[model samples]
Target chain A: MAKYRQIREDLRALIESGEYGPRALLPSLTDLTARYRVARNTATQALKELEQEGLIQSEGGRGWIVRPRPRPRRHGIDRYSRSTWAAGKAILIAETASQGMVARQQIRELAEVEAPEVVAVRLGIPVGTTVWVRRRTTFIEDRAHQLADSYYPLDLVEGTAIRQVDTGPGGGFARLEESGERLDEINEELAARMPTSREAIDLSLPPGTPVVELIRTTYDISGRAVEVMWSIIAGDMSSFSYRFKIPD
Target chain B: MAKYRQIREDLRALIESGEYGPRALLPSLTDLTARYRVARNTATQALKELEQEGLIQSEGGRGWIVRPRPRPRRHGIDRYSRSTWAAGKAILIAETASQGMVARQQIRELAEVEAPEVVAVRLGIPVGTTVWVRRRTTFIEDRAHQLADSYYPLDLVEGTAIRQVDTGPGGGFARLEESGERLDEINEELAARMPTSREAIDLSLPPGTPVVELIRTTYDISGRAVEVMWSIIAGDMSSFSYRFKIPD
Candidate 1:
């Protein structure tokens, strides 16, 4: 094997074995070169390969550190269970708490804006129709993990808390139910894609990390799409699980 | 805005407006340079940006062409409904037919191998247990769209059609049902990440493309894990939709 590839494999094994835990720094380039009896460039090449594999990241002059694999936020069907949210348990808080992390939802932007073409179609509203949008960044352990933008038709939430920055307690769905909407079903469409530069910056994603785009439309008893939420979640930090019966 | 960014935005608007449809060739470097009155490098930078955004790809000496946005395979819950598959309707065939395309499943490998750790854990079997693995690549219109590896316990499928390269009619699930193990439910876990070099090559993925990893476990009526299938799907070519009642 090439000298650099051998070194990379050695380091990869160490990282995978958890000898170098998350955020743990690897040996300095000089040390690696001396230890492996290789040139400085060869040592650098080894680290670069690992970085490209999303294993470790260079900390500028401080050398490379193992990239922390965040506890994946599992989005199970039960997360949206009406009983859980209706009882005043916020899903984000409950999720993070179970993982022993603090959670915070920052209301980034809340305003009445013209609905985007995609959002309008999901909400079954007219193109260019005015809608109340509440955009927020969900943070786990002070690190941004998700960007969610929720849109509601102006007429449906004209005076409701869904138009506010903070929808309180059980979040927007509970508020919708209080207004007599009676939440019934949710349709989620998921796609994986390379994040746009803007999303990469907002989510602090590592290079080579993709993001999962989830568009969830919640419907009421009348089968009207009451809320449409678009979420961009750091793919490395999340997994979604769905359980369903085999329909006849 | 910088000159390259300005040119990029102009091209983006044109592409978005469908003036430059999928697979349509973009203006040549020389044509762009002359029209924009910019240096060759500036024009190159603009095209590079579009490539990075996954909107275009270089065709060697043929210049750049808009990347074809493959008709996304929408995986609704109905795809797995018993009626759809039990009636001899292969989901992939039905899906591509609806999109006016042909579908083919290429069975690349069939072997009895020692179960890997993750597969064993999901299958509730001991590690290194001998299992049957059927590996296949699903192609849409002759383009590889998905790679699926399905694992089954040897004892369960030792004499079944699942051990064959062709599982006939309804595929492995159907054969399992015919063996008297009635299918009950499915649990799917999904994540997204940049593909490995091998996966990228197998999928013919372009730069900036990601892959969605879906690990699905099928349970029998007795709640035993009958099969575990891991699928790697080209992210840009597919979307998964799941609809379910909001659990009480």
Candidate 2:
């Protein structure tokens, strides 16, 4: 194997093994050169390749540090619990709160658009039905984290606070409850796959990194899907936790 | 811009859009060539790349077919219900039963091994404590599905039936229950990442295909860890579904 390839694979294993946590600094280029007995240029190239892959970045005096990863706390089943959302916090915020990280949302745009066929199916609405789409880029510590494009039936949300630039306290789901429908359950389907050309550019994911394509649907007590959301999550940065009872 | 890349991206988008169901046939190379106005060689190359990516495969006369992906039934929360297990079937079997596929476990080996530090932490046992490990490679329709290695403290099972090649009736967990512990809950942590070099070869996962790294800890009524399992699931061939109630 090429010297750089060997070094790259070793470092990759270390990261995956959780030996290096998010934002943890990796061995310096000098350390790599001495340990791997390779030329400084070879060591530098290996690190460069890893950077291009989006797994690491040079932090000036801090040298190369693992890109801020989504820690274990970013994913929890209780994220949407009434206590959390009704308390005026976004589920995303609650998901990452255990890490002591504050998340901010930048609403890029909000529009009423025709729902795609897939989204329509999930919402039990006619394809092409006008839907309210709130597009936002979520950030952790001001760095891009995930992209959320949430769709709701326009007819249902048009006159409500959900149609506003800010959905007020508790966000959309809480407002949905205030609209007289209570959210009873949520369904999430997850898949790991390479990002689309758009996602790669938008998320700044490194090469060889996959994205978790998450489709979430929120259902009211009437079993109606009031919200269908598509989230593009950076794979390496996140982990999802689920706790469920074994039915008797 | 390469013609093949254009074709590949379009087809990939279509797959991700759920336009084609599992095992559905993709457009033929001839059709792709005509539709995209690309040379036959270019279209073939596109299909070839996708095949290498494990997104699709070609059967002799059937042309290109979407690789068999895990349907929604494969990701039910009820998979571990007592009824399902007591019926003499693995939860994984129940998960894929809706697809009309039978899964067979090829138990590669069973042995008593010293617990690794991580496993020891999860199992609440001392590091290097003797433990029983049942390593198995699961197959669906004779294709490798996932690798599961389950660990249990030797002291808890040295005199029980769980140490045998076949933990009769339901499964090891069932036998564990019979040995006086009642399962209370399950905690699963899921991460998506590229498979390791050994995993790629063992699971026959295609290059660039990510795997869902699932670490599951099964706890007894008293909240003690009884078993710790690590499952490496092929990303493309699997889907995970979670349904949780929003607290009232």
Candidate 3:
């Protein structure tokens, strides 16, 4: 395992140091295994690590190739501006326009279910209380890049459009506002880890790929918990930027 | 590979479902390989993946043991609050205290050097301009948890403690303030990926361990860039919380 990591380091340094430009093609897995005199799995793991870094990709039948595309920064202030959504936009996919990639959204399901243990705690509701749950997937360039499950207190959405398959322009955020649950604050918590098998299957992530799990809690202007969202963001392609003033 | 993942998922579900509690011992790697009828490397990989998730740990001669400690949320807003460090504290260490862990810091190096391309761009300085570079590593319970490199323009820190091995009580932030750079805002750009070999070594991370890389840009009250910090936070152990209000 140590040997595998060492080989990956050497190749990564070469690629990132500009010795190999955008068109650089990496050595085949077979070539690496033979050169390093290690098992094929060793070399494959090394390549998989780079693929998880967004440093290389398998070009059809060809071997691994470098990609020079820039990863877009999801700016917190700009992306979350009330104006961005009030103008009728999907919050997460709005920034994708600059990446020159087509973003496709699929509303997997809209259902009313008893809140799970985790969701209940975040939404300040009883574990068995019914809540409006929306599960959605986002695809960029035909590749699933994000998966989200958002839970809203049933009381806040019982007669609102938020319970439907499509919440229309601006999605749920706008709907919540029109219903008097004007969002006052959003708290986002982030962590990273190896993707679970279920997540790996859902995102079609490569081996060794990690996912950024973001738990977001939204509160109404009166500080009432309105919605709690859990999202798995593709680690290799997603980045977040936040601007905040340091409190005295 | 599929077999390995299948085994991992099954065992993970069992643990999470409370079939095995915090102190339960996992089957040995050899036992897993034999039971699953797979290559030893495949079994090792599966176990390594779990270790990266902070679910289990190798207890030396005792083999792998389960850990059920809740991952503590690292409140980003409070950590950067002036009141946190004003009382003579390291902001990051302060948050770790809530986890009941002791943070030991090592001042790796304090030097003046020409800024790297990335640092230069963030600092709004020439590529080869001199800067005060401070690299430090933080450990919790003998395990490295965070690695950070902070850079400041030489002109701003030439006569401050920020260029010393230990920047007194509040570290560089205090020194920056003492030098007339009253920090008013900070911007953190976050991304996740498998750790580079150097980062893995610095943090003593396991295979498949992904790190949350935060690039923080600090600006003074006058909106002039004062410092740019790059930090690699331990993936499974640390979580960041950000609280922001939607503007009218």
Chain B TM-score in candidate 3, rounded to 2 decimals? 0.83
Error of 1 at A14 (Å): 9.3
> Which candidate model has the greater lDDT, 1 or 2?
1
For candidate 3, write residues B18-45 as lDDT tens digits: 8979879999877888899999888877
Give fnat for candidates 1, 2 and onward, in order: 0.86, 0.79, 0.83
Q: How much is the lDDT of residue A215 in candidate 2?
A: 90
Name the better of 1 and 3 by TM-score: 3
Against the true structure, whose lDDT is highest? 1
User: Runs in model 2 with CA error above 4 Å?
Assistant: A1-73, B1-73
Candidate 2 per-residue lDDT, tens place, A65-146, comes to 8876545335877777798778887777776666788887888779999999879999998999889999888877666768
Clashing pairs in 1: none
Distance from true location, Cα of B34 in model 1, Å: 10
- Tens-place lDDT digits, model 2, residues B141-160: 77687898999887678777
Would you list the rank order by DockQ, best first? 3, 1, 2
- Model 2 residue B248 lDDT score: 49
The C-alpha local distance difference test score for the whole of candidate 1 amounts to 0.86
